[model samples]
Target: MKKTNYHTHTYRCGHANGNEEDMIQAAIDMGIEELGMCCHVPFPHYRKHLIRSLPSVRGVRSLLSLLKAIIKDGPNMRMPYRDMETHLELLSQYQKSYEDKIKIYKGFEAEGLSVYFDYYQKLLYEHKVDYLILGHHFHKHCISNDYFGKEKMTKKDIYLYCNDVEKALETNLFSYLAHPDLFLIGYNQFDLDVQTVSRRICQKAKDLNIPLEINAGGMRRGLKNINGEQLFLYPNAHFWDIASEVGNDVIIGFDAHDPSDFNDAMYNQMIKFAQDHRLHLIDHFDFLQGDFKKFQSEYDIR
Candidate 1:
């Protein structure tokens, strides 16, 4: 184990705290040798996308948040597009300054949005990012209403999540899948449908040689009693059991939102979780390139 974490967030993402240096220093202090700054991806025309997605918006909170994002051009769930240049530049500077202490990689944790497939591809092919991880939190749009982890996820929604993940994997754009079981967050029960999707996702990752992340964000939420069963929103026992049986490669992501999140206790807990499930844990993975040309030619994306 090299003590690496490829899933980390920065202050530019709005929801998280600390700058790139702060996060890197924290990781170094925790003896983390390799750290990837994978902030929530900033789109090129975020406001335009938000306005275009208005028809699909639902709920008071979701609508309000969408409006706020459109009005302020600030981070609602992701960093503002205008901030991307400065964010990456600063990370690049820190990468050099901290070269002796740690290995830093620039990346993004992105949703599987078809509209942004070109943008995501550009980020990689243009050398703007080293890698990307598929964190498919939304369906067609990034609004809370379309969020896969919302409390009201239906069987249809989970299936959609699985479908999006499978499609994203096929593109070979992402190095790994983040929180592959996030669909189980609000769905509560792990029934036959859940089992089917879980196996499908695990098998796909196994076949593609992409690692599945055991995200700590869900573990940080603590346990909940669902029908007399205590379970974390994700890294759900049922999901990982299927993954274990399928023999998918697993990686433990702190999913760090703050500097303090890079501690020993959480790391040990994640390790124990992997050990308990008999997961094939790996500390590193190959950063796969996004085959945009091939994808475009096959799907006629343009």
Candidate 2:
């Protein structure tokens, strides 16, 4: 298989390290043929949404973080909207500069928040991004209380996450589902509810013709012993068992938060995981376009 990774992040996201060039050079050194820079998407008027979500803030830390984001408009979790133009412009320059070494594409790892659907559509339609991947990390808002990857997500939260993913996929905006089993990070145990939702997510992606990512980030976290079985937090054995059964297409994502994450060890691990699961792994995917007419009608845009 040709080495390619579509899920990569940059230092602009605050939580990650490495700049655009640092990441690109790493990919080229690792013999990656194509690389997509899909950092956590920045939002315009992010503080407005954070302020509106004040009532939903649950704990002191989360509340404080939200307040800080509202006040600073800095990279709380993502780059600020003010940095969006510069980020994309630099990426465009790198794409051209690195054309001979590796194919580069601009993209974002985005949340499936309804409030930002319009913004996502704008990003795609305006050619600002080549694609968006559904990395639904939060529900309703970007606060910690709504974070799906929190240490204690409820059954209701998982259901809401699944619903948001389905809604986003239906919009045809997201090219693939990133870490589709992210709920498993907090909600341990491969019980009936987990099975039900996993099947639903896999089936949805299968039907939509969007590939599900076997994210290496989860693998990098190391294995956890859950219910007598040691498994990666995501690309969870149980989840992929369902995905394999449902016959969904799979893609290996470095989900690189650092330049070193583009190494052969992680890549090989992902490949073997896909092979072990009997997943139909693909090296590339179609850059699905956003259906602006449908988006306009659904959002009641003129």
Candidate 3:
């Protein structure tokens, strides 16, 4: 398993546990050589008035309601992440702390929203972020904050989700797709409709030369049994089989939400699962490692 994970979260994300240093030490203990601290990037929420001139009271109420439903701990619960300046400063410290042992990269798990494209880009341009991973957590069709797994997914939902993912890939903004099969979270079955969308996603990733993540976070959450069958919502057996067939670049994302998640046993299990499926798993990605050097130079990151 090479001991590298780019899909890690921090305590500032509200739902995730542990501070950045805790996760860093955990990775070191697990013998990780590289760790990317991709904390959740802050997202902006628009007021109804800003978009359509709705009543002030109505706008506030609606925004609050939407935030409550979508944000696990609500809007004011956490900073979501340190501000860009602070984030970069922390990254410097973490890197210096483990200079000879592990490589730590600064990045964000950003939402793939056309509306927020400029916002994300601003971060990259102004903050010198190392990379951004595509995490289509919210449905962009309506720009709602509702997360993918919070609702029962229909084929229509699957279509919209995959479409958004494809759009994100087309932008060439992300280093890789985080939890590419996340649309399957609430979907219990791998029906023909699901298969169709999954195939489309894999093909698009192949076409774009974007790596799709086989996230291990779901394993930490455990498995779901549907129709007397043990199934995982993601790192989905069916999806990977299609990915293996499509010949898309695949990589493992620990999606570590906490320090404890950096366990060796869990890491080995996920790697074994990918090997069993014959999915193309690479230890590190050029875009994330070597290619990013060019990216940083282009952006004048240093």
Which 10 consecutive positions of candidate 2 have the poorest summed lDDT? 293-302
- The runs of at least 3 residues in candidate 3 whose Cα sits more than 4 Å from the true structure, single-residue gaps closed, are 44-82, 141-145, 288-302
- Indicate the TM-score of model 3: 0.83
TM-score of 2: 0.97
- TM-scores for all candidates: the values are 0.97, 0.97, 0.83
Candidate 2 per-residue lDDT over residues 1-302, each given as its tens digit? 89999998998988888999999999999999999999999988788878888999899999999888889987778988888899899999998998999999999999888778878888898899999999998887788878888888788888888888898898888999999999988898777888888999999999999999999988998998877788888879989989999999999999998999989999999999999999999999999877888677645652
Model 1 global lDDT (CA atoms, 0 to 1): 0.91
lDDT of 1 by residue, 124-216 (tens): 878999999999998878888888988878889989999999999988899999999889888877789989999999999999999999999
Clashes found in each candidate (C-alpha, N, C closer than 3 A): 0, 0, 0
Candidate 1's error at 300, in angstroms?
13
Report the lDDT tens digits of candidate 3 across residue range 118-172: 5556566654677788988866422333457643777788888888888877777
From the highest lDDT down, the ranking of the candidates is 1, 2, 3
Q: Distance (Å) between predicted and true CA of 13, model 2? A: 0.6
